[model samples]
Target: MKTFTSPALSGLPGLRHAFFTRDGGVSKGIYAGLNGGIGSNDDPADVAENRRRMAEAMGVDVAHFLTAHQIHSPDVAVATMPWSPEARPRVDAMVTATPGLALGVTTADCGPILFADAKARVIGAAHAGWKGAFTGVLENTINEMEKLGANRADITVAIGPLIRQPSYEVGAEFVARFTEADPAFARFFIPSAREGHAMFDLAGFIRMRLQRAGIVDIDDTGIDTYPDEQLFSYRRTVHRKEPDYGRQIHAIVLAR
Candidate 1:
């Protein structure tokens, strides 16, 4: 199966990871190719098989490739071991320090961030939509990692493929919400053609947040999901008036 990795996390010892794209797997129509979103409308069997492929690629048992329900909240779930889909918690991020356990998060348009502290054998995965990011999901993920013995300075994070600034337009209220939280955030938005809308630099904003959290090593894939046919995009689905969309998986594991 096709996958991407960040240079920042690629050289880490005893870690395995992939930022998967919608290029491999068994699904049809809009959900074609590596659709791993367990909560999506895609057939359960297909999703299961796709996830199995991801787990195999990460060198873990199929049952060990774990992901959460992702409610776009700041909530984070710590994983000591794998859990069945029925037992997955309702959260937007996951962290793990246990060997042989994989932490994953699914996303279409939202950012999928993978983090690792090789020295501590700790790793994290987060779904950073605008709501989740603004509300502190990234921060919460790091805090949980620290609780598991990861140091912020030792952490290396990768911002995976997502809707980039050029394709991400926001309403005035969206801009206001961010600026209200911190006026300096206004720089992430640039005026768009729409009277009250502006383009948002989501990746840049995410990087700044990581910097503020004391993380020094960061890498962004710089791949935009919206126009990339190889990746699934919720906004692209919406714009096409499709009834549903697929999601790609981003996972990191502390290898056994």
Candidate 2:
């Protein structure tokens, strides 16, 4: 039931952020409480309740809640009410300077990042999976917030619970992707127990990327999804052959 509200962003009274764990919902078994994804096998009622509670916890109306279709792309969307829950946009990042909107991102071993520049009243949330991160979702999200009047330097951000370095082993080809992008990133990977494979530090690489983006306020609580029983993990569930899995939610809201 632990909630991680980064001290880095806590000084911004105008912003609300929550890195929720698996403790507050009605879901059971693999999709236990607070499972918000309707796409999962969790009961529709449970999913609805999870979303309802998440919105309530953040003190925003459920309808003000916003998220993308989450294609793992770097695209960012500006939130406008007359909200469209029906037409999910094919994007993984969302930003808004407008008040009364809750920008959200879902994750299961992938990074969920919440950003805020209270001075400009701009906020953003991004789903930065490895693929999305590789494609520059973090930078794109910061760019979107800037478009809405945020200064990247002033924007405080917290990267929430995700798979950690030791828990994330990948093949050499995968390691090649980052090295290919920028040879400097090669240091983030180290040889794992498996042959030709290495353990990748996703959060560390993201921090480096954000730092390169000129963002100063950055931090991660270092919660690992794969080993943590509370947080949901797609990779963990898949390897276990579980029928379905739940998604952990990471959300931020601008005070009304």
Candidate with maximal lDDT: 1
Per-model C-alpha lDDT, please?
Answer: 0.92, 0.86
Tens-place lDDT digits, model 2, residues 1-256: 5577787777787888888888889998889777877568888888888888888888888887776778878888888662766776779999888788888888888999889998899999999989888898999999988988889878898988989998999998999988998899888999999899999999998898899899998978888999998889998998999988998778888887
Over the stretch 9-55, how does candidate 1's per-residue lDDT look in tens digits?
Answer: 88888998899998779998889999998878999999999999999
**Which 10 consecutive positions of candidate 2 have the poorest summed lDDT?**
80-89
Best-performing candidate as measured by TM-score: 1
Candidate 2 ranges beyond 4 A from true positions: none
Model 2 global lDDT (CA atoms, 0 to 1): 0.86
Give the range of the ten consecutive residues with the poorest summed lDDT in model 1.
Answer: 1-10
Clashes of 2: 4
